[model samples]
Target: MYDVSNPHYMGDHTGTRKFRRVLLKLSGEALREPGSTDNISPPIVEDIAAQIKAAHQTGLEIAVVVGGGNFWRGVSASNKGMERATADYMGMLATVMNSLALQSMLEAMDVPTRVQSAIEMKNVAEPFIRRVATRHLELGRVVIFAAGTGNPFFSTDTTAALRASEVGADCVFKATKVDGIYCSDPNKNPDAVRFDTISFHDCLTKQLKVMDATAFSLCMENNMPIIVFSMNEPDNIRRALVGESMGTLVNASGKDA
Candidate 1:
């Protein structure tokens, strides 16, 4: 149940609004420029920070879960003969780097932010504490969750789901290259159909790759809504925060396929 009296409450329980607080899931590749040698492009991160700043100005509580694919991919490394646990730990550290980069840019714009790493790194960030993270959101500080559950086999997607549920966020906004969920991969299938809204059960039954199985399962179990949209479009993050419908909605109330 949502408490209307909570200072962090941005919407009412009567369905007049949605998404008071949300978790944003971003891929490390989002910060990288295509065909560039650099792992992270400053210009791209700046753009993303600017968008986030714009949204934060609207008084939305934002938490971010970013992946570490740009610097390292544990699964890929493990596939290439590295130990899975070691590679994943390194991958977690890579997320911290991205988190710090985003935090620096946001602070430069005067947006209060905090990075909480699942893996304790006292020199750089606060350890992941659910209450502290939620308090940061209530205080209008953007919280960036790094380190992917601090585990070897989990993903940042699962982190988003877990943190969103733990913090009682309204939804999880998944930023991706595609506009929304489709019947098939739009890149490979020209005849793919996009759904404006789809039920969690439908996504599962159809085997749509909205997120990793663990992440999707977590959301489904928690009744957490997810919005999947393209982050490539300018001001899309701001638009999404302000409740402009531009992506597919995956939730319990969605129509069954």
Candidate 2:
């Protein structure tokens, strides 16, 4: 009954993906429309949940780290003269809300989901415990990590890097507005080049922005791979999980550099 059609269901009967374990990083802005007033669109997230359900049925262990930009941006607020820590904590709370919303949507779709809060909001979600989260994955549960590293001055991008490592995920899939890594701002620079793959060393040395420096550094240091792809096109998430290669793959070896 979805207004938008779901991807062809892979179900429990499908072939294995190249990556058996993955961490998906979704931005808060992804849940909202570009010019609309709604902070979180029901149909959009429903479709996303449907995609995740299909992907999970493919037998991959999935973890999600969602940002709070749709609700609040701490750094942007801090630049406007508010106290930095207070602003960041507010941003964390916003992520909790987004996580609860996502958990509700996924569970509504009959996909077993858990919301693990880094801030310990026991009433709403389980506390973030690495072992417990890993066990949840082993049990075929979709784990949503919220509250961003349980500290101030950190970002959800950093949270994804840390959790992906802790959960022993094979890779991190960053679903965003842009389709892949570009040599320059695709919007501002019409002649910018899109890279199918890039090495972490080049991403750093050339100052290309796959993610925040801290997050990127962590992934590089740990030899973790990241796939950056667009979420605007339907089924991109499923394609990514299926390893169809629609995005830029950032790797540890500077082979592609």
Instruction: Per model, state how many residue pairs clash.
Output: 0, 0
List residue ranges in candidate 1 displaced over 4 A. Answer: 1-17
Cα lDDT tens digits, model 2, 1-257, are 10101122222323222667889999999888789989998888888888888989988889999999999999999999999999999999999988888899999989999999999877999999999999999999999999999899999999999999899888889998999999999989999999877877788887887698888899988778888999889899988876665678787653332
User: What's the TM for model 2?
Assistant: 0.92
Q: What is the TM-score of each candidate against the true structure?
A: 0.92, 0.92
Candidate of highest lDDT: 1
Give candidate 1's TM-score: 0.92
Query: What lDDT does candidate 1 reach at residue 255?
Result: 49
User: What are the Cα lDDT values of the candidates?
Assistant: 0.86, 0.85
Model 1 over residues 1-257: C-alpha lDDT tens digits? 22222234344444323467888999999999998989899999999999988888887889999999999999999999999999999999999999999999999999999999999989999999999998999999999999989999998899999999999998888999999999999999999999987877888888998698788889989888888999878888778766666678787757422
lDDT of 1: 0.86
Kindly report which residue pairs in candidate 2 clash with one another. none
